[model samples]
Target: MNEEVENAFLPMTSVSSGKGSLVIHDVYCYTNQIVNICFINIPNNKWVLIDAGMPKSAEKIIQGAEKQFGKGSWPEAIILTHGHFDHIGSVEALAELWNIPVYAHQLEFPYLTGEQDYPPGDPSVDGGLVSEMSPLFPNHSIDITEKLNPLPADGTVPLLSDWKWIHTPGHTPGHISLFREKDQTLIAGDAFVTVDQESLYKVMTQKKEINGPPAYFTMDWDEAKVSVQTLRDLQPELAITGHGVPMSGNELTRELNKLAENFDTLARPDSKT
Candidate 1:
């Protein structure tokens, strides 16, 4: 049996919402409302979905997958960056529908199995209405133990041959990012975003800028800073974050290195601000 988080369709949206872009022939990034979910495939062969989208987005994801990989093609598995509500919104549905396994970090098992809740969002963080409204966002965890599997102990992402899962905790204890050394491609799941997720205006416009995790729910600024630095050192030629658009080339190099170098000033909020 599978269970879902209790959440309705959020009113949030972004200019990039509903758009899908191919970071490469194999990696496709799709924005549902405000968050980005990746559809990675070997085209006409096997594929895996990175994260489920916002609540009420199951159909959208199904349709997108069929369009990308063809009708009746289900992913080998669903790989979660973390068990955040938004990221796992459609997990139960998709997992049930496809009869596939869902994998996440073992440290996230408590939340995914409904044994605990994430710390509530902090609305006092700087930026905009998104941050100010954070408290209202759901922090409850849903039970999905039937389909949940911990990522392998060796850091390899199941079914994704060329990719390795890097523990990028901060936003959540089990947050992860995917890196493919062969092409220097990174799929950063909110370890750092390409948009100021705290700013409502910026989120809506989908402005591209390197910023830290969403300030509202991130539990550890210090850990997030280190995760960003870990990713920057990889020198990824292309990166698709969970928010904003895909960033690549010299812009990615310059922006990612800059954000990692100055995370304290650019990302961490003060004691009260």
Candidate 2:
């Protein structure tokens, strides 16, 4: 009953966006300066919303879903990759709006149920504006107890027949990535990203490059490295990440492999140990 919602909304500028197929479409929220929210199309008119976007984005997400699926449409459930503020900023609002169940890994429950806060972002890790502003980003946990549910222990995602949730930690204790084995399509949360999150200019431009999680928020570099390798081992042909554009084929393979091999040099921050 006591859910914390952000009062101030980040100013945004609209930008271009696209989809992989009818099965998956993402709306770029906060104009393209923030995170992406995905809508996974189920067999019937039903669909699933993956990771709510920034503060005050529930309307944008709802409108985008209506435009893609149809007017007066609502998803069956909401699946979260993690409880990062950006990912779940509007979750409490949207969950109440639609009165749907929200699922997340059990390890993430503390953050979602208002029991704990995430570790502070390390501004000393990098010198860019985003890094400089890291200290201001919300690190408090939200209380969405009534609507929250733990993911199935067997790793099967409800409502999504073909996709499975893979435990991919490091960025957060309970981070998970969604994968469709048939097409090897991966919905990589912050387990790994396709952009240099340390740079504001690249994030604003929405660059396409394989990299590790956002440096400032990642608490376990070793786990992050292992998590990247775990995903690389999956050999996902196509990957839609928490940031940047989607990538696939041999190019994605090549860059991902390189990132996995040279993670310390390319993705790890200077102060993390």
Candidate 3:
């Protein structure tokens, strides 16, 4: 298949989240700015890519993987937490180049398969420049129909037996987070994040604060709150979210609980679109 990627957005250099992985590697991206992606290492040099970073980032994703697992290594599969532009930006390019399948929650299929586009980001939500700039961000869906696959009904994840995918929507209908029962490590995606994503400074500094998902792109406030509470119930010892540095231990626990309990004040928008 012949594929062409049109990158009209600004491009910034990639940065590592510097969180130091136990089971995951953080490959950060800039769309003109920054976001996070996870490359999870499984046994035998095989791994999985979770949430493609910013638009036009396939090269950075591949390079980050090779740096971790050595040359010529590709993931067994690419699993998306959601179909938002930042999360699935380079999906088509990476999936096609690697000749691998991309898996996402069944509800996310429409967005991934060229069937639907996400609602526009709500720039009215709180934040500064980032939130204000969001209305200009892409909400259009990309078609990767041929390589897209629905996540397993049984909840088991491919290539990583120790981990299971948990349905944690709200940020998007089909959003999911990966959990490892053994260590209680959670890849929370955008269900929640470690930074106040609405703030451009915090994002670039990789600040470590437990906050709700990115406000501009998140449409369902109630579902997002529920998702945060559900994840808090997991009591993740370590959390690697879609943005910011990895947070862990009592700090992670304490902040996550606070966010879940006071989601309205901390996460909910003053006024939504």
Top model number, lDDT: 1
**Per-residue error at 81 for model 3, in Å?**
0.6
Pitting candidate 1 against candidate 3, the one with the higher TM-score is 1
- Candidates in order have lDDT scores of 0.87, 0.82, 0.78
| Residue-level lDDT for 232 in candidate 2 | 98
Per-candidate alpha-carbon RMSD to the true structure = 1.8, 2.7, 3.1
TM-score of each model, in listed order: 0.95, 0.92, 0.90
- lDDT by residue (108-192, candidate 2, tens digit) is 9999988999986678987977787777777779998999999999999999989999999999999999998988999899999
- What lDDT tens digits, residue by residue, belong to model 3 across residues 22-65? 44343322222366677776777577888887676677777677
| Alpha-carbon RMSD, candidate 2 | 2.7
Candidate 2, after superposition: displacement of residue 135 in Å? 0.6
Model 3 local distance difference test score:
0.78
Query: How do the residues 1-273 of candidate 1 rate in per-residue lDDT, one tens digit apiece?
Result: 122245432548999877787879899888888899998885459889999988778998888788777898889899999987789888888999999999999998998898998887787788478888877777778788999999999988888878999999998999999999999999999999999998888899988999999988899888999999999999999999988899999999999999998988888888432
